[model samples]
Target: MSRHSEIKKTVLRGVYEDNAGIPRSTHGKRQSKFAADSQEPVHSSRYPGKAVLVAVLGLVALLGFNLRLVTVDVAGPAAMQVVEEQPLPSYRVQLPVPVSPVGALIPGNDQLVSPEPIQSLDDATITSGRYDTMLTRLGMPMADLFNLQVQTIVIDPGHGGIDPGATGHLGLKEKDVVLDIAKRLRDKLAVTGKYRVLLTREGDRKVFLKERVAFAKENRADLFISTHVNSLPPGAGSLNYVETYYFGPHTDQRSLELAEKENRDSDYAMGDFREVIARIGDTLKTEESKQLANSIHKHLYNNMKRRNRGLIDAGAKTGPFMVLLGVEVPSVLIEVSCISNKAEEARLSTPEYRDRIADYLKTGIVDYLEERAHRRTIEGGIIQNVAKQER
Candidate 1:
């Protein structure tokens, strides 16, 4: 080949081909062309490996960035999803957050606060101790507590207003007589200033039996005394007597009958009242009332000088009388005297006789209080011992 042709061939080969073949004249020509064209020439010797290294590094960086995005997409977006059904093996996907530890729970603001890292509900056992503590703190009233000296008493007057209870043939009503007696009783009780006495009716207003009981409960009255007059069946002599009644779950028939009659209004006959009484009869079935009745019965008989019916042995019965059922306190009904009998009713209408009854009741109340004070002294000792042991 001619030298010029050989040089051209070598130049073309050096321009396009890798460092496999080369000639001095061709290399010079290439360098001269590059210089004249004002183009920067690359040093191929160092560039190829560098290019490969850069490509490999760039590929690795792209792969790492894509992996990071994928991980975030998998974990970050579904954190708040609720698990509606129990997780089965197939469905048990790992959550981003792990279950919180039980040790994280600490009391805050008088309540338990979870201290452990919270991830799920499966971490700790729920406790009822908080509720139990609250209930323990909410105990009985200070008045009923033996350590406290507060005493509560409730006074109930039988019949009022339109219900002219037990109208004797002499035109005297048991309602008026009982009210007069109640006022006098209140006055006498007030003079002592030791008992907290509440009257069921302050005026000639007719309060329902339930209302009387509720009044006692709302005030947390310790003792409930309902004053009324008695009525005897036909052919019985016009004898004067005082009767006391207490209520229980299943009281004597005579006790039920007496409570029913005394509670009856003029508008309703005995039959109608009995039906009304039947529905509520079971309410007073608790055994506590029997003790209450016994206490009142014992005091009344022991204090009063009048004809004693000797407790009537009614044995703490229950009936549907509004006044007795549902009264939380110890309750008793006092039939001071018979208003149905003409002579007895006439005497009840007199203020002097009413005052006499009031005086006798006041004495009974004092005796009951004295007994209660003694009992409370004993109970107080027991309670202190129990509290110390509990602590």
Candidate 2:
């Protein structure tokens, strides 16, 4: 009994101390409310715990529902509005574009435009003038011109077919006369075993001067020789002459005059005027050409006939001769003899006389080869011997 009483007294003392700071009336009210609540709380129902858990679950569900909602934006610009919800572009392409007008493909003036205006014959003067101006521009001459090792030789018999070269007296056609002579020369040259010769026309056929030059170039001819017969008034006495022509400039004025006369076909053919002038000018300055002409003339004069006109330095002559202009190789027009003279024409018609002329030409060619070979040997250089064979 005493122990129970002591325990109760301790409990009462602690409760009194806890409520010591509170007002007496409030402490009495709390104690009375707790006593009433303690009387009913003998067993816990757990209903309040269940309700609090339900409230917490409801708040979590609300937050989750708000987070799942999607957001959309109205954008500016039609192009932007069409974009998807991605970070990368949907298309890429490469396109070819037309080129704008650029600088002139031709050198010099820069303002040259594409689809340029069509130039009339007169309007094209500037184009031609440009070529003329190139003369003063100065550049290295063609290296092949100085290179002596060219291997091909093309020979053109002046007239053939409908276009008979020079008509001779005594019912002799110029075409037939020159063809016979060319054949003889070809045969003689073939015997030397030096060149592989090509005739522009093998038989009676008209070959344009342009076509002749083209043939030579196509064959890569190192030399081009056009053979023809000359004509003059009566009483000129049977005369035979061998002349060598280069592009331009005469060692003597007479030589120049002869070249000009021989090249007069250029005017009839309407050849390139500017190119003709330039080529002639350039030929005139070449020392090798003068030597070549003299060498050929010398051989013909000595072997063929003492009266053979010696190498006449035909000065640089200008002509529209189509064949001459087209040739990229050393070229010459050989006017063998005057067919107008009765004696010479009679001689030309004979196979024996033609063979003789061929023999003389062969000798001259041999001389030329021998001299060129010696020069090359002395220079310790290669000699590119042009080759011409008959047939």
Find the candidate with the highest TM-score and give its number.
1
List TM-scores for all candidates, in order: 0.53, 0.52
Per-residue C-alpha lDDT of model 2 across residues 164-187, encoded as one tens digit per residue: 766676878778877887887877
lDDT by residue (258-297, candidate 1, tens digit) is 6556555433444554554443322212222433444444
RMSD to the hidden true structure, all candidates:
40.9, 47.2
Q: In model 1, which regions exceed 4 Å deviation?
A: 1-146, 262-292, 302-320, 386-391
Angstrom error at residue 370, model 2: 2.7
